[model samples]
Target: TMTIANSIPSEENNEYCNQFHSKYEPKEILGRGLSSVVRRCVEKSSKTEFAVKVIDLNNLDTNSEDARQDALKELRILRLVQGHANIILLHDHFETEAYIFFVFEICPHGELFEHLNKVVRMSEKRTRGVMRQLLDALEFLHSRQIVHRDIKAENILLDAEMSVKLTDFGFATEVETDDCLTDLCGTPSYLSPEILVVNMYESRSIRVYGRPVDMWASGVLMYTLLVGSPPFWHRRQMTMLRMIMEGRFSLDTPEWEEVSEAAKSLIASLLRVDPGQRLTSVQALAHPFFAKQELPCVTFDRRTRFRSAILAVRCLCRLHRAYAMPARLELRRLRADPYTIRNMRRLIDNTAFLVYSHWVKKAEDQNRAALFENSPKMDLAAQDSG
Candidate 1:
């Protein structure tokens, strides 16, 4: 039984900090920034792992009041977007006199930025999968009128399976339908032209710039994922801002030669100078680029069911052997019989062939069906047959 303390009153805040430590054993620091450090923690009772972000209130670099407010704002936004699949889960939070702790679901693989650093670049298939999850999370946020003002690679975390878990809502804010956000926030390379225009020239010409800013950041992220570098980056900060403002990024680079035109087109649409002309989250999700890159949907039939049953039985058999053979000597003495091994190998080969065959057949069928449905001749043939 975990006691979830939503918030501790100012008077009892210090006392609750002890309670948090009692419930969870804080471990090694996972990451660190100027204002905060995230550490791995394990709940005492259940031993479930979590990530705890501890924000220092006494840091002279940042105003204590503003830091506290930012922490509270992140808590509110995390709660608002709770249960979203692609967004990071906030299990609990605690605030003390000197620190505020945010307990989140542990993403063992760390930030997308770190992953991209290692891989340098991702294949179109991998990029599409990452983009899809990111866009879905963004769409979920936008639906609730919440803008994730910061959507850089550093803020995006990855779980064990490499699924996107969007985090760091410190800059997130809820906007009404007609509201215009003038805040010049987010990473420099990922910031939209509208934000830069306002930031540099203090221009009031861009009357509306809220959710579209997120779209622009997402576009930058996609470009980064595909090309291994930000599209608008420059050696100098001012030069980078100028490039972003002028929309001077080029797809003519050698890195982009292998990228599909559909992807380039979507990036262009998202990075449009006019925020109004930029694709919304929902529209971006519907882009042809993703459609082309997505894997074919798998439909389970009798053969798949049979193959699953065989695999399940094999797993059970392995479990049975494990339970029955505690001693290494006994396990070595009663090894898998030749008959059993042969049958297992045959079953695995058959299963693989059947699964591959089924997938190829399904994809071909889907493509043929799509073509036929779109053809006027097929429609006339149906009419004649009727």
Candidate 2:
């Protein structure tokens, strides 16, 4: 493979001739895909950790001209989208005798799909935080005329802060004016109606699809995050595809009860059968679903309030029982002194305030804790109002 590396006629391959092992020390394998293996690597000088994808070019299947083109395309897309905050950052690339090494910022928290599986579902606030970042990333890509054909939970990475880092450019492509992407690609669960239409009737269907397909997939991701499953999942693949093509999915199920109407409305717009009618990334970000609502001035819960009131009453009752007899004799004498009665009233008010304040503080703490439970550090209060 090394001797034949120069035989590849691509100019892009010539740009990267550094030995992969000379600069970075490769560590344990992080993951493996169809044609590549991702391993953790650290730069010798900077000692900065990164994820390196090593693609072997020795195998006959991976050494073809088409394979080389695909690799170059991915590298181009990564370089184009690198600086965006939400998109994965590509540091550098290297080419050796038998492998191509692409170094990217390491995301230690793993895939969002794995996180969703562990939590089952996410709170609306957390879901909003994730969606906002995802949308912003898409907006950047679309603005540049690049479409990420595959947008699924598995392709999204989570960092230590739980922020989104969209990855996987294996199917991404730049769209030119008047370009019609008819290739049947992407995971089945996230396929847009237009894409499926093309697949169902390959030659018969002449419909064009591009960026809106990504919006549709984002809608699927939002639904999955909020409801714990894809909107159009089914036992039969054909049935699921039909449902997707028809835009058939219900948000009226019990799982959706807790989700806000604004969120449901946004999802509806994204899932529109007609690509032109679907909400673009900019429109989706401007939707009311992501608008920041003010948290209440006071975190009040009925049970907490009631418990405080009950306890205050119980204390009063116990005090009365212990002081009733003494109070009768003392009242006659004390009633003559207006100052004593005023002092007693002030004491009672102070006691009540303390009891109420204690419960309210406890409830507020509990709310904060629940908002962050098993989640990343994010400003959820701005996104979620409990």
Candidate 3:
């Protein structure tokens, strides 16, 4: 009889951690996926935190032999993905009799979906910044002949400084053998038109296409970011599929008033109905939105500065919670960090920073002028009230 531990959830009853069992102590549940549950754990020896994804073989649709084969396939594919910043970093994976464990780098900030929902929307400049990094990641993956079949907001995560990191490779497939896959699997909203058509007809003769599918998904994501909801939304799945297949949508929203024409044009290019017409990662990189933007200088001191600034903010928030002190104290400490101040100075050198600075200054001046203009009216009203 299997006695369940209070620490593990009932759904994960069939799974148990065995690899490096002596090192890590499970802390809390991070999330639950279709076939696995991820937990945050701390390595006792190094005091380093990691995310452990436990997949139960008994819960899967496969027998022991098939489970082993699928595990090996996943491992091989994960190993092949090298030096991609956008993809999640897989440290190690091991299997026990009843479960498979995968150790990954802990992303403290959580998924992009959560962030976007919390904010409701992001600024065009910030959105472009994020998209650029995502494109770089995709470029690296496509260059390695890998197709991240699943690319959506949920799979994209944020690091401490709000840097984007792509996660979840369970649905990813590599394009190594010139094999066209027919398995239509991905979030429906982001699915390309071709996928909708195949699914509509229930045709097994259809084959999985190449990297363009990812590009189409990227376009959908771009649209989602610009407009609060997906390009096509319907109460019924079939109606949604019809909209996607027809490629009929308009961006003529009041929100478009604030977004740049260039940005809108890029979105149009990426969201083209024809996969072949969609912008490739390299071509997208060359767009004005990402063209010649200076990336942060890669240096040990710079890295330390950025990390310290982020950590200080996190620690300050935690301290405020624990001690019931004013959060401003944390802000003061953060501002006093010489490293952070210097990094801010360097950040001003970036083109984006310069553009933002100009706008900020202009807005500040206008605000001051508006206050002055309103003073006489306010004074008149006060006099009458008095």
Candidate 4:
């Protein structure tokens, strides 16, 4: 019953706006940004709740092509990702002269960092789980010849079970046939070196950047998830920008002492200075960090199928009870699909191998102890004893 296709010829209809208000009663204000206000609303018929993002066109200069394209681009990408499980779903949308309305699947748990802020830092297992969904969404976009220029944790939302849903494609763009794209439209700290700031007067210089910008941001995401802060963070803006441009970041922090080399390798590969050297989403998924010897492939047994279905339903009910999130039936469809089942099985299996376990921590402690035991003073004492 709800649909959002593409832009139509601007039509004047007060009835449409009035009908929208009648159909969905706004409950609570969820969030507000400069461009839009997100409100929790309930559809009168089904009584299902959804988040409504209201963009007031009056705030933007209608004559500015840049502003118009910026708003439309999000709708376009949302339309493109109709069936994508890891991407946010667009339930319904409408546009009037004064405002454009977007109804989205409500994600009650909120932003990834909001969760991270509570935990301080994530265990490797939790981080990997989150990163898997992020990579899945990114891979989906990349495959469709689209680049989500911004891949920050704030743009990632969560359901109750903590599965990620990637959102906010306002800066996303379709790659040309040449596979080249250029835009200085990402959070400055997360920006890749290639999104060069060209002077307005400079016509000769052509700055071409592409998907690797996302890879760089993923590396930053990886670091933040594991270490609780960005890799290139600095007190000064220029300093941070310089670090990103120069690819000057290190895994030599105290957190890295516990982190596995496999994780470090993935981060280094993603944060490569040259875009060509950066890991693609596919390659990153194939890296050792994500590898597992055995995957718990779903069985044909009826009990196993029933159990999975029940677990999923229970999870949904739990979330629904907490914050009234709408049923994400698309996810139920994915759970039924064998391909998603297999992929999830392997992703779950791989988390068992992360070095943050007790044995690795004990090994590190022993190694440090052994180094001190074999110190120069100990060596001298040993020689004297001999």
What RMSD does each model have against the real structure? 18.7, 17.4, 15.3, 16.5
- Superposed model 3: Cα runs more than 4 Å off: 1-18, 61-68, 176-179, 202-207, 292-386
Q: Which ranking of candidates, highest lDDT first?
A: 2, 1, 4, 3
TM-score of each: 0.71, 0.72, 0.69, 0.70
lDDT of 1 at 32: 76
- For candidate 2, list the clashing residue pairs, or say none: none
Could you tell me which 10 consecutive residues in candidate 2 have the lowest summed lDDT?
360-369
TM-score between model 3 and native: 0.69
Off by over 4 Å in 4: 1-17, 61-66, 177-179, 197-206, 295-386
Candidate 1 residue spans exceeding 4 A from truth: 1-17, 202-204, 292-386
Tens digits of per-residue lDDT for model 4, 34-68? 66778888898999989888776667645545565
- Model 3 Cα lDDT, one tens digit per residue, 1-386: 12113534555434443344565777778887656778887777888898888776767776866876676677776788755776678876766666677888888999887665544457787888889988888888888888888898888988777888887776677786424655688877778876765655765444546787788888878877764556766646677678887787777744466677888888888888777788899999898876565888775788789999999999999988887853333444333442234333234223333343333221212211121111112243345568
Give the candidate order by descending TM-score: 2, 1, 4, 3
Q: Per-residue lDDT for 373 in model 2?
A: 19
Error of 2 at 175 (Å): 0.8
Clashes of 2: 0
Q: Indicate whether candidate 1 or candidate 3 has the larger lDDT.
A: 1
